[model samples]
Target: MGFKSLAGKFYAGIVQKQIEYQRKNAVSLQQKIFLYIVGEAATTKFGTDHGFSDIQTYEDFKKRVPIRDYEELRPYIDRVISGEENVLWPGTPAYLAKTSGTTSGVKYIPISKQSMPEHITAARNALLNYAYETGNTSALDGKMIFLQGSPELYELNGIPTGRLSGIVAHHVPGYLQSNRMPSYTTNCIDDWEEKVEAIVGETIKEDMRLISGIPPWCQMYFDRLSARAGGKKIKDIFPNFKLFVYGGVNYEPYRARIEESIGFKIDTIETYPASEGFIAYQDSQKDNSLLLMVDAGIFYEFVPAEEIFNENPTRLQLKEVELNRNYALILNTNAGLWGYNIGDTVKFVSKNPYKIVVTGRIKQFISAFGEHVIVEEVEQALMEVARKEGIDIVEFTVAPQITPADGGLPYHEWLIEFGHAPYDLKGFALKVDQALQEKNIYYKDLIKGNILQPLIVKSLKKNSFVDYMRIMGKLGGQNKVPRIANDRKIADQLTRYITN
Candidate 1:
């Protein structure tokens, strides 16, 4: 395949130069003021359009614009559907990306033309940054496949809209366009059965090198590919494949199974993506943190994680944030979101102002007993225990359930899937218990008195998680099974065999 089909090498080069420049000069006084102005301007527009005309200055904007949840924006969404002139911004919304929330079954987040460019630029920068870091820019010489949601667009009258993926795929450089699979048009919204069949059929015949999308869907595709090829590994299906880019949910649970099916530890890159924008992405070889796209037309704020659940919370400016501190993210972006508490928490591992680790979702924490344990704490505990035990865990989830002991205090029951099962399951459980004790002293104290005994380890059958997701109607798409639950609903559903 001809790699350099377009003379647009300049675009890539320019992005490279900008990345270097921003790395060295991202936190200067000028950059700070520029970001402040951008944030204020975005907020002003957001407020004015939403009937807060008095929000002209920064302080006024801050006071008048309360942090909005998606439910609060339904009125504006209705206006957009009615084809109002200025429902979101100055122009009509070009696209509405559907995303699900805890309360809202499905939401259509309006995407304007102004927002599309930022998504494209951030995505391109992420790809280029990976290439620069790994010295593998030519990886694009082969096909890059995204196992994403149905690419269909929906009309106002409920007609099948074409695939949104195909629409975005077309925007890539023409030189690299041929490397896309299932051509966007054909992949657009079709019948679910037909879409899966087409994706699987074409993927098996193609030279797919780079794969990207939600982890659950990718696992489903890998299973389909494996079965189609008569139990062949994913590496055998795409011999030239080297990278697996996943985001939208935690990859820890699916990690072991995916590597086993692929027959190798494929280079993995995680991202934090949403319908509003692509917020952050892990680099080629970095496990520390994801680098934020500073030039992606989004200004950010950080509210201390401790304050997120408070009645009166204080938020920090980008300049005021520190490394290793968990902060609930607030974004002011070109997508018409201003001071938007997108309900995600992140922690900085670097002070360069552009790199941070996504700790977890704000609402995804397990606090049934008011211990207020976040996902990061659980992940840390798991990683530490695994390291100490000299084992590799593929996936795990913790659920809070009541046992018959001591009048029903909430206790944690862990479901862990290990790459290699230990001969002594009791010892493994003890190590996990000790690790959690060290991280969370309260849990340790409770364990000593038999308030929460070390729970049983229930090893899942091969591909059990995948089958469970399939039953939930969340397989083969954007929906991801949560890694930590406040209650046992999902855990019970996943662990029915063992529980029985």
Candidate 2:
């Protein structure tokens, strides 16, 4: 058999086991995960200090380790960086994923030897699940063009650190590596503009079969590829392109733009991989919900989104979460992230198979006037408006314009970068305003009470967000335009450089 067939069979076997285990029983899965983690990490300092030795049950485990975010793990991570062994896990981490610190400067997420394989396995299974469920192996026979981050890795006190996609890229098996595009040299380009040009030159004529990356960046690539083809859609450039694997941000708003770039509809698979670990993925082509990776070397916990910011909040285990409620994710992974808050919100859609959809980031919202507009709501509103007005937006960001100097009442300021501008800009903005009012009562109340004025919409010059991300040094891969800023900090900054 060919290697692709063999690999397909191998991935099929593993994914089958996963789907079966995923549906076996939530309680049993959780128990097994707890035992696996404690057993593997019991020798580590953090584990032993937290009484992993005597922790025979979930209650015991939870009682010992309080929930934490990256801030709370700073000391331990610092120790690990300083060459400490077994600080959080059984041994030193193989690498640290340098995540976007737009909120906190930079976050170094440890990827231990034990946990790295689980991540790879989970990623592998995401594709395998898609292939198996669809009964299509054409993608396996063709090359994949993963629009990954910089492939360059840097060292921090003897440990490797870089974007997670970059770190993971270095480890793609030799067989798959041969089928990958953007050659290692091109992937290492640190500058986004230069890198995309180089990638366009390299893969525009290649028999690329799959494309994967954050939606905004992918749109940039597709646009450039179309330009290279003399205005032909990206599908003309890559006829074999079958699957578009994406994650890290909402895809709803970008779907129309991406499909337009593709010249037709295409299959897509979504992943929920945080810097901490691969959490969940779209397992079936028939549905939109993602299946949780229940057996993927991570113990899961959930805290109701409403109570997550409170002084004390109840943490709910896997089976304890109800359907259709936003909950913040917590993880106790084999990587030694003990009860760590990943900071993304999700809502369950199914219990029989434990399916979920990512809602938004815990910190990614606009709430300057108590009108808490979240990512999901804003994205849905944008999509709804775009559909209504026949407009195509490349990317956008919203923030509260709270400077009373502009007007007495604060208003939401949107800086929208468009691929195709609407003929009726005013009507487009009005539709978004009405849609958001329909979705968020607090925002409606603010407008009704005259506490906030109507939203201010600014059409940005093409490539505004692109230029901004390039300036911030966070252009490609999982990096994306922040949908909502806590204040006008980012909005004002972008406006200074990109007024249309």
Candidate 3:
């Protein structure tokens, strides 16, 4: 083994032990992080206003700080943007993570110096744990590609501001810099297509081994690479390629197509990362559930998914969460976000070491007829049908069609782009609809009571989603179409690309 591989294996062993220790004492570790964050930020303006100094226990903290979203916390964030010190965290923030918001125009999530390590360390541990489990550290010696946003950042009131991925680009560890592909100059291109072209040109002939990014963008990269190589599968071009590290979306929907592009199935690591914090990562390949980051610099709270919008929701700490129950994830991070609702829901699959599966976004759901169908249910339904029928789905989204032009009962509409169309398209749609009904009781009830009709599947022209995203100026990076929406904002626009 080379020096890099040897060093990686050694580090992986150490981190594996540390992770085991943290999992064993998850509750105590969370308590320590809670106290530490509260103590560290006790003198900040937000802390003073919330009486953080007087907060003695979880109950006290809960009473003092109410749960808040971006809008509710905007006043303090505004003060920070105006160059105020000690407004949110101690002193000034190290950086501001810029992200698109649904209600708010653009959200600026503070990333304090103290909190920055949480992001970096968790990412590092993800790969290290992979090595520990699989006994594969050769990727550390080969080229690695991370398809992400442009690293070019601008200052917001003296604080570096950019997309979370771009901000993270600046902090790539020194050892990995040499192995990382696509030159810094190429990575700074503002236009995503141009940037991908640059990346293809830069890394096409290199020893590319590890590829990481959100699924759709990675699929785009794979397409570009294959076209450049005269339709060669990725594995043929880069024989050493392995280890696909991805987050932001579930990999099941895109897995078949992604594997086809590569010409073979490869190992993958799923992660749950957000602007609020690096929450969890898949620790074992055998177990698909992500191990929650209990020892990370964040304290977590869970509110039953059903009670998320309640005036007084039941908030449970780490030790209190039950298995198989959907909970809205709340965070109290070292970045000075107290009682913060991150808008994601999770279901615990295992409570022994706190492993969870991301259910869906709290806000992104279809409930037009009071049938509250979530992303997980929809994805699961489609995956079941696709797997059974051997269909290749490029991209898809679900929205309620409240008004039908044909004067039929309103029903769910699925806009799908198929790489390989199903032979029995209607049968495929019916199977997916039946699967969805099985997954959601409310949806089943609606179908049974004739309140809603079986879903309609509209085949979208190839590259329709790409075109939509391009038109919206969100072609690449971490941007993804919502899996399900209550309204037709996205579905209506997508109609223009419906295959005749």
Candidate 4:
């Protein structure tokens, strides 16, 4: 506690200065950050193409770079991967983060030397903000175990490539690596279950104070630890554990189980770290809204989610953004990604303080037959049912069921695993259908027109999602269930798993 108190005090001071800097000139600081990145890489092919030398202001820069997605930026990234100098950034990209959030296949994203610190600093400040806001520094004193992908690098072209978490783990600054755990031996285990077992064995006796991971995987860790320790709760095993940091999924569904595992509640912090960069984090103690990472070497843009697929969508910079509207996120970063759409949709929760809530992803949906049910609608519907029935759900995914014959009706198929199952499957399915119909007019219209049948709800055995993810080789760390898929690929796989 003494060591943590001192470190917290030091880190808090740095955050307060950041707080002041952000508070004073958020929009202006973002503009300057953009210019600094452009100026540094001005002689590069991309910079030259975008008229980087003539761009003096946000308005000027906006016209030069057209908003794009990963496919659109692949050419430049390919050049960088081939060891071409000054293709995008001033020098070769130090690393590439291969992520699958946008599709079933991987998207190769560059991590330039300039952008690497953005990841580290954003994470560091998230902790600093927690300490400053709550006046609790004990977490800094003990082992801060981060459950992330292994740091082992794989080669693609001439560059090192891995998941973003693995890359971050590899680049952990010299000062914090010694204080972090599990042992290097355990951390390098590529298999998630094996890693969890090793981590539990290594960490069970340590004076651990902080735990960070995606919610479901961390829940699994806590469950394993409790079972190994004669069924005692996490607090009984690691009594000093005071902070739980989580992200990479919506925390609502798994929160209660995690708290129950711990035997009590602890301060929880949320962050929005994508493969591209750290987007936002929980900076206040009072609410769930995340503070935007404005000055972190990333220039931000937002296109109204409704307008995203339009031929010529309006892309709004920071100042033009309005609160409470869903917008697809875009980033032009020091990483040399220009006008790239990272595919996330976020709604501003607070304009005066600049806070946001990640609503869903651009490509995640069940739009079969033009019903167009989005993740937000599905989550809200499930959440409503959970609240009404007093049952906890571990995870769920949706896929459309289309009829092959004219006499048959098309419908939705749901694969759900419950933390605690509800007794009435029929009634529960009715409620969920009603909720979705209420939330989505297209869905209701389809139902009213007899274009779609009532949704089919299938109860999965306990740990079904875990097993499904395990089979997919994505059982831990930052991996998450795809909320919705247009086709039956995910649903079909889950069906096989459930039957067996």
Candidate number achieving the greatest TM-score relative to the actual structure: 3
Off by over 4 Å in 4: 101-104, 154-158, 404-408, 497-500
Question: Candidate 3 on 1-500: residue-level lDDT in tens?
Answer: 78999999999999999999988999999999989999988999999999989988999999999989899989999999888999878999899999998778789999999888888899999999999999999999999999998888899999999999988888899999999978889988978889999999999999998999999999999999999999999999999998899999989999999999999999999988787789999998888899999988899999999999999999999899999999999999988888899999999998888999999999999999889999999999999999988999999999999989999899999999999988777889999999999999999999999999999899999999999999999999989999999989999999999987
Which of candidates 3 and 4 reaches a greater TM-score? 3
RMSD to the hidden true structure, all candidates: 3.7, 2.1, 0.8, 2.1
- Candidates' lDDT values, in order? 0.68, 0.84, 0.93, 0.86
Give me the overall lDDT of model 2: 0.84
Q: What lDDT would candidate 1 get against the real structure?
A: 0.68
Candidate 3 total steric clashes:
0
lDDT string, candidate 4, 1-500, tens digits: 47657877787988878876785687897878877988987899998888899988777877888887888788888788888889888887888988775453777789988888889988888888888878888876678899998877888777898888889997777767767999878888989999999999989999889999999899999999998999999999999999999888888878778888999978999999988889899987789889898888888989999888887789898889998899999998888888898888999987766789998888888888887798888988988888779978888899998864456898898888877878888789889999999999999999999999888788888888898888888888778888888998888888864532
Question: Comparing candidate 2 with candidate 3, which one achieves the higher lDDT?
Answer: 3
User: Candidates' TM-scores?
Assistant: 0.86, 0.95, 0.99, 0.95
lDDT of 1 by residue, 1-500 (tens): 33441223445667778877766765563255334444444433354564445544445655655566677767766676566645455556677666667767777676667777767777767776676666665457777887665555567533222334534654666656778776675466444445666788888978888889877667767878899899999999999888888887767656767888899988878877677677777764856378776656566778898787676678666667888888999876655666677888998888764688888888877666556667877887777666666666655677887763466555677776666666677787777667777777766667776666654566665556656766766655666666777877877876763422
Q: Which stretches of candidate 3 lie over 4 Å from their true place?
A: none
The 10-residue segment with the lowest total lDDT in model 3: 268-277
The lDDT, on a scale of 0 to 1, for candidate 4 is 0.86
**Candidate 2 vs candidate 4, lDDT winner:** 4
